[model samples]
Target: MAVVNEGALKKMLKQYKYKDLTVREITNVISQYKDLKPVMDAYVFNDGSSRDLMSLTGTVPVSYRGGLENCL
Candidate 1:
């Protein structure tokens, strides 16, 4: 498994090119942002990739897609 150092995590956030901020990055930055949760309710209709959220935030508790427990 690849460990995400602060620099690496910061790089990933930067790659997103978000001017304001992102929910994912917000979670990463503010660990107080309420712990693990998926990006479903955070969506309206098409919330983009469920897979990406899984990859970015790990399992995303109670998510139907399950966890990427195999990836590591």
Candidate 2:
């Protein structure tokens, strides 16, 4: 099982509250701090499949704990 970096996620969320980051930005951001797949699924938006990170937002990450970039 993958682990959730709550500290990193929390920091990303705080950043989101201040500004909007693009999917690429978010992708790169999380890549620097934690695992990509888990963070995208748990925090960003997703249909449970792989897709360009730029297209998902607002809808997929609806009930997420973190708010960084768009979901994968």
Please name the candidate that would achieve the greatest TM-score relative to the true structure. 1
Question: Which predicted model would earn the best lDDT?
Answer: 2
Candidate 2 structure quality by residue, lDDT tens digits, 1-72: 335455554454553543234434555544554434423334344666543222223323333567545353
Candidate 2 — which residues are off by over 4 angstroms?
15-72
* Candidate 2 C-alpha error for residue 29, in Å: 19
lDDT (C-alpha) at residue 28 in model 1: 59
Instruction: Compose the digit string of candidate 1's lDDT tens values, residues 24-59.
Output: 455553353233332322323475643222233433
For all candidates, the clash counts are: 0, 2
What TM-score does candidate 2 get on C-alpha atoms? 0.24
**How well does candidate 1 score on lDDT at residue 13?**
45
Candidate 2, residue 31: the lDDT equals: 53
The candidate 2 region of ten consecutive residues with least summed lDDT is 52-61
